[model samples]
Target: MELLRSLTIGQYVPRASPVHRLDPRTKVLATTALLVVVFLARDFAGLGLFALFLGACLLLAQIPLGFVLRGLRPIWFLLVLTLLLQVFFGGTSEGTVLWRLGPFAATREGLVQGLFVTARLVLLVVATSLLTFTTSPVELADGMERLLAPFRRVGVPAHELAMMMTIALRFIPTLVEETEKIMKAQMARGADLDTGGLVRRARALVPILVPLFVSAFRRADELALAMEARCYRGGEGRTRMKQLRYRRSDALAAAVVLAASFAVLLPGRFRW
Candidate 1:
């Protein structure tokens, strides 16, 4: 529960750093480019460089390393499962085996593949966290709406999609807090959530989940009513108070991101 509360995935951190001051469009584009580079990377050398770049970004953002990394704790199980699956099932029988457990074997090639894949997943999460950490929910929605505006020509509901995404992101922390409260209330009533097998513990969550779902629905209804009370409508004619504009800093940031992306691509292309 504490870990869930500590998650920085959808939460925004306010700071005076350059990254925070960057235009939301610039950050969105840079993050997308970085994700593309991460997927294109072919070897550990390229990944190492990308890691360094991401570390520098975090520093520039003035975000604490611990805060950014704590988000990984909730996903550690998935990461480990991915690595283990790759290590045991990724390589061919001809490859050198590093270890054996019954019929399953971990090969050197498999280890490399596992580490590379896991690194990609970790970097992807961290890169996205950087975007949410620096950009406010309103800015994120505006930027996403702008980025997707081109798709509107194809009859896509870009503004509505962006609004939905913004609401989801805004409510993630709220839901987590609500879940924590529900769990505590249950615990105070002698609900035994611990000291049980996986299935048993999952069953124990039924009581907590019931009220959680009820509360979530109630909150959603309240939110809808509140918006209606304010005479809210779709984004057809909506305008933002703080319009997004690209300044010199945004241009410089874009250039730097592009250059870094090119650097990451070069190694994979030329085998440097």
Candidate 2:
């Protein structure tokens, strides 16, 4: 159950909205632009603007605030650890010491570093979460393939790579559900997944892994046979069912992303 629960990464929420309908290429590009700005943000003000942008995107995407925040819960411990490390180990020119206890010294710069670093992480996660929340795996793969199409000249199997990524993303939820079912069955047969030490808990995962692997291989074999029967070859000369095209909405979205990046970089630009 614990491992099953841990596999909750990249779960998509079903929603019918403009954000969901936008060209996946637009969403992917916008997310990438935002991520670049996030890393380029030099101060707290820029980071705060990044957070506001993320919140705005989440709202536009119609994803619940609770769901967006839920993803952060699992990483709370790591965030805390980073905060503590920054608070204690970060110092520029031995700035004003806030406190000293048992060979550990906390300074003003350290405090600033800790809070800003943590805030940056929060903003980054929220931004990326918006993309995953709005775009489906299939569309994302199509977008990726389109974006990487130029690499085909270099003998890169861009389409094949995209297909593999799409399949992996598609199976995450299915595998999670399967693991849950297996866990329930094992529990019915008197297996306590929680009550054990580290080694024992790891050993207990063997049963789950075996079934998961077996089912995965079975699925792969079935897929291969089906493809072969249909005369499917590699990504050569394959056409798309829904050809991705950039629309007015996608153009507007890209414009907004560009504006936001500029806003974060130069807040005084719009002052009149």
Q: Point to the candidate with the largest lDDT.
A: 1
Model 2 global lDDT (CA atoms, 0 to 1): 0.83
Over 4 Å off in model 2, which ranges? 1-9, 267-272
Residue range with the least summed lDDT across 10 consecutive positions in model 1:
1-10
Model 1: how far residue 178 lies from native, Å = 1.3
The sequence of per-residue lDDT tens digits that candidate 2 reaches over residues 40-132 is 788888888878877787788788888778788888898999899998887764688999879889889998999988888888888887888
Candidate 1, residue 115: the lDDT equals 93
**lDDT tens string, model 1, 2-83?**
7567776768999999999998999999999999999999888888899999999999999999998888887999999999
TM-score of each: 0.96, 0.91
Question: What lDDT is obtained when candidate 1 is compared to the true structure?
Answer: 0.91
